[model samples]
Target: MLFFVALLVDGILAGSVYALVALAFVVVYRVSRVINFSLGEWVTFAARLVGTGTHALALPLAGALAFASAGMAALALAFNHVVLHRLIGHPPISLVMVTIGFGAVLQASTVLFFPAGSGAISLPVPSEPIEIGGLFLVPGKLVAAAIAGLGVLIVARVYRTRTGLALRAIADDPQAAMASGIDIDRHVVLTWSMAGVIAVVAGTLSAAVWGGGLSLVLVGLKVFPIVVVGGMDSVAGTVVGALLIGVLESEAAGYLNPVLGAGFSSLAPYLVLLGVLLVRPYGLFGTPGIERI
Candidate 1:
């Protein structure tokens, strides 16, 4: 029915957005084992930078996007090298708290320097929505989703290559990986770099769909549920989780509106996330690793 179709579209869009952000979280966690509470701020930062460059500075869209991405990448590198690297070997809880504190500092700084209040900003990408059989699909969302999917493939391929294998080994055991001649510091830095790129991708797509500025800041938190549903360690699970959550949420909003109160649909992903965590704490594809007696 038409109702079902609408729901499907909404869910896909939501899921795609979550998946892209979640990809960054999973990547960072795999490499550093640090849960970045500020991941969403990076998306917001990139979006605002691109938006401000294009709208305020009058740069071309391509130039704006590129400059914003580069700036974010640089910041990511700085965080890894200057901040996080020094905190290694600290207590896990202490390290996590530090990152959370780091995120707060970044958020405050963003407000002070940028001073751009939250509102939607248009993306630099094309604006024409796609239509199929009379239903309109947001072209920006579709394009972003496609790009994220392609990125997963490319990233996977990289994981199989020598450098990527080394990264994985480092993730599995830092001391052993270093003993085997893998550069742990470099791998960690590289992981942050890769995550920065993905965050830029997510930020770009988000600005296209939802505009830019402070509105995009919370995208990092939005990724939590997606990564939770998708096994944190499984790339394929991320893709699957995105699609499922996206479509389901969309459809729920459309069809269940009459039965449930307004805004109920928006809660679908979190509900699913909670349910999954309570039921399968390791996540859908996450393994239950054990220690020897």
Candidate 2:
């Protein structure tokens, strides 16, 4: 029971970082219906920017994270205004391809420019662990989880606001929303902007947790299952999905890793994703779309 409890907490901590990543996906998807396949690149980019701040600008970790967050948000907004806007009328497939190309370009740019991030990154946090009710927790992970929880809370609260409803309106049907004078373009920009900020939070916390590098971009791929399981369009479902995957992944790593050989834990999330798809095509919380045709 104690072991189970510990694993549960660990999973929650890990899932917290993933939740932010999934939220980044959900935010943009809600308004644009575009997957932003390259979204993970921004996570890697932001993590790299932190290294830039610490080395070039001599900023501390907190300052570096702050700088990276602002920079990423600005970059996302600019990308929306310049690139996405230009491709507004293109086919969805074309947009997805563009995102794939953009990801490649961003990856290349990151390698050429942010050399510090080519390899694994290590963030220094206190070595001491926090013990509660016979369970020990890492301080860094606890902090990251707290921050992630707050981000989730804020997002949930936002849905109740006027602007948030307008954003949802765009998500329901961009064309109809536009006809209703909801200013689809502005909402799209806002969603992307939020995604950028969410990326930084996810990336930075991930670095502080396991580490950071170009590999962190795989975190993007990992989010597919999360959003699918949690309901790609449902914020509350995202939280539940992250928690479920986190717990399962952690448990697999701890128990199955030794029995099934190493790396089995890594495959756990995808297995859950497959199961979810089989059981509920629309996801545990995702809304079912009605086809006019």
Candidate 3:
């Protein structure tokens, strides 16, 4: 019982990280229908910038975060506006492959520029752990969770407001939305900006939780499962899926390793994803089509 409780706590923390990343994935997809395989590279780029700014250049932590996020945000906006917008009606598969290629380029560029392979660097965020009833909790993880929750609320509320309602109208029908005098380019840019900020937030919180580096990109990758388990469009589903994967993976590593071996522990989420795909197809909260033939 104690073990399960501990697992739940740890899972919630880890799941917060996953939720943030999943949120990033969903944001871009919701607005532009881009999968953005390059998101991991964006995370790696932000981590490298943060480490360099704070450690190498002797900048203050707040300044470093601002610089890193700004750099990533600009790059994301450029990538979306210049490169992707040109391919607006291209085959989805082609766009996805292009993003994957772009990610490789960014990763290679980071290796050349930083010369420090994906080594871990301490985050500027506070890292002291808090204890409750013998369970140790990292404050950084809780902070990340709060930020993710706040982001969802803000976005939802914005959608409820006049401007947000306008965006939704665009989402519902881009042609009509444009004909209705909505600035389509501005909307697309806003979507990219939102996605970029979300990605950086995930990278920063992850740097605090697991340390900063290229390996932190895996935080984004692990979130792919969360998006799969939850519907890509469902923010609540992402949060719940993140928590479930976090606790289950941690518990497996802690207890099942003795019997199932260590190598299999990390694959738990993928297994869950495969099972979910087989059973639910669209995920826990994904849409069910009402086809009329």
- List TM-scores for all candidates, in order: 0.89, 0.92, 0.89
Give the clash count for model 1.
Answer: 9
Candidate 1 TM-score over all chains jointly: 0.89
The residue pairs that clash in candidate 2, if any, are none
Any runs in candidate 2 off by more than 4 Å, and if so which? 117-125
Candidate topping lDDT: 2
Ranking by TM-score: 2, 3, 1
Estimate every model's Cα lDDT from 0 to 1. 0.75, 0.83, 0.76
Which candidate achieves the best TM-score against the true structure?
A: 2
Tens-digit per-residue lDDT, 21-129, candidate 3 = 7777776776676887777787777777777777777777678778777887798899887889889788999889989988999888888888473334454456777
* Tens digits of lDDT, candidate 2, 1-293: 89888888899888988888789989888888887889778788877887787777788778987888889889888878888788877989988988888889889989898766433334565869878999988888998888889988888788779999999888877778888889877778788878888887788777777777777887777888888899989998888898888988888988899999899988988988889889896788999878899
The TM-score measured for candidate 2 stands at 0.92
List the candidates ranked by lDDT, beginning with the highest.
2, 3, 1
Please say which candidate is ahead in lDDT: 2 or 3: 2
Residue-level lDDT tens digits of model 1 in 1-293: 87677667767766767787788877778878888888878887777777677777878777876777788878889988888888877888877787787778777777877746432455445677677887887766777777766777787788899998897787778889989988877787788888887777788777677666666765567677777777777677787877787786677777675689777777777889999989987678766567799
Any residue pairs clashing in model 1, and if so which?
7-250, 7-251, 11-246, 11-247, 11-250, 12-246, 40-220, 121-211, 121-212
